[model samples]
Target: MKENLTDSAYAAGWALVKRLPEPVATRLFDGIADFVWRRRGKSVLRLESNLRRVRPEATDAEITALTRAGMRSYMRYWCESFRMSTWSRERVLASFEPEDVHRLDEAMASGRGAVLALPHMGNWDLAGAWVVVRGMPFTTVAERLKPEKLFDRFVAYREGLGMEVLPLTGGAGTLGKLAQRLRAGGLVCLVGDRDLSASGVPVEFLGEAARMPAGPAALAAQTGAALLPVTLWYDGTPVMKGRVHEEVPAPAEGSKREKVAAMTQAMADVWGEGVRAHPGDWHMLQRFWLADLEPRPEESVLPDPQGVQ
Candidate 1:
């Protein structure tokens, strides 16, 4: 019953938000963000804590201001996502201006396939739409949500945008599917910043230890695909900006396990650069760092990267 209520609430919210005028919805989201920030909601608090790790030297006043801005940015992502399905192809193509995109283009053209590792920042859906417009439809894995209806809704949403959605909990076959896609010169985008599974690869991020999903690196290593880290943030109102960092190639000399670890750390290092530049756009409201996590016995054992593949 509770799951049904939650699912219905989300469905209703999406319907209403999509129907709203752009200006009206933008203002409404701003108001909502302001209210959440003022109330110090758990989401806002978690975002603030995450920001502190990004900018440890920030004063209390600065942190407070940044938190408010972060809330606004986070709300903007929600607003854009709810309305993205209504966006036209031309509008989606114009919404994002990418930097260093040639790296991805070249990889795709080479027929070696490419793995795009992205952090949770900016409007990733917009980026995905742009990629589809550019003529390369991609596949992405999504975490299973509590309410099955809600999970189905999200899968439908991405599918409507021309992406092939796979379930993270689909077991070993999931990774096999992704690798097969890559070997066929396909694109696979993975959210690489946080690990949803207990067995994520440990890495140093933003000067602290954290676990990030190893699927991106493992996929690259297994398929000999180009591993690239991409970062997205708002350039201004209604415009999204992104940068594709240099590719992290699979090390030819290391063991597969060592190569995966090294590549994962390299991706983290590039992600830190982007997050630092636009801290507010990073919508990392949940616990991320090792220090922030509660003690769990299973954490000591690395989970198979295939779990998220």
Candidate 2:
């Protein structure tokens, strides 16, 4: 019963929200953000805890201000995603231009595949759309959302925008498919900031030990794809701005295991630089650091990402 409602809500989002006028939609989504922030729900609190790691020196008041802004940014991502399907080719290209995109161009031009590893910041869907409209289709992996129908909705949404979507689970030969795409000089994009799997490589992120997915580094290592770290943020404009940092080359001398670890850590280091610079744009709302997984008595009382969190 609940799952059906959940799926219906998303179906309605795509069907209805995309049709809203710009100012009306903006005010509606912004109001929802402020309401959720005031509630300080679990997601909001977790977001606050993560932001604290990004700025440990901030006083309580500062953290509060930052988290509120973060919520606004996060909500902006959702609003943009719901509305992006209505964007035309010109609008897509005009929005969210990256600096140093020629790095990707060079990789694609060389007939070697490129892996675009981005953190969970800004509007990734919009970024993917921008690439697609530029005539460069890419393959990306998505976490399977609950309620099988809901999963299909998301997959269809992305596919409609020219992406080849693969399930992170139950999609057999996932790595093999990615390698094939690379060998064909295609592009693969992965959200590299979170360790959805327990086996992700460990690294120092934002000055704390966090595990990040090793898939991006491993794919690049095995397929000779360029491992490019891309970071995104939003300014006051409708444009989603970002930078494509130089590629993280595999170490010249290391075992297969060691090479992947070193590459993943280097990627993490690049992520730290971006997250620090655009703390509010980062959309991490779940437990991230290894230490956060440990049991603690005070965990229940943690401030949510809303006003108090």
Best by TM-score: 2
Clashes of 1: 1
Worst 10 residues of 1 by lDDT: 299-308
> In model 2, which residue pairs have backbone atoms overlapping below 3 Å?
37-306, 37-307, 44-304, 44-305, 45-304, 45-305, 303-309, 304-309
Q: How does each model score on TM-score?
A: 0.93, 0.94
lDDT against the true structure, per candidate, is 0.85, 0.85
Q: After superposition, how far is residue 292 of candidate 1 from its true place, in Å?
A: 1.2
lDDT of 1 by residue, 115-164 (tens): 99899888788898899989999998887776778888888988999999
How many residue pairs clash (N, CA or C atoms closer than 3 angstroms) in each of the candidate models, in the order given? Answer: 1, 8
- Each prediction's Cα RMSD? 4.2, 4.2
- Show the lowest summed lDDT stretch of 10 residues, model 2: 300-309
lDDT of candidate model 2 versus the reference = 0.85
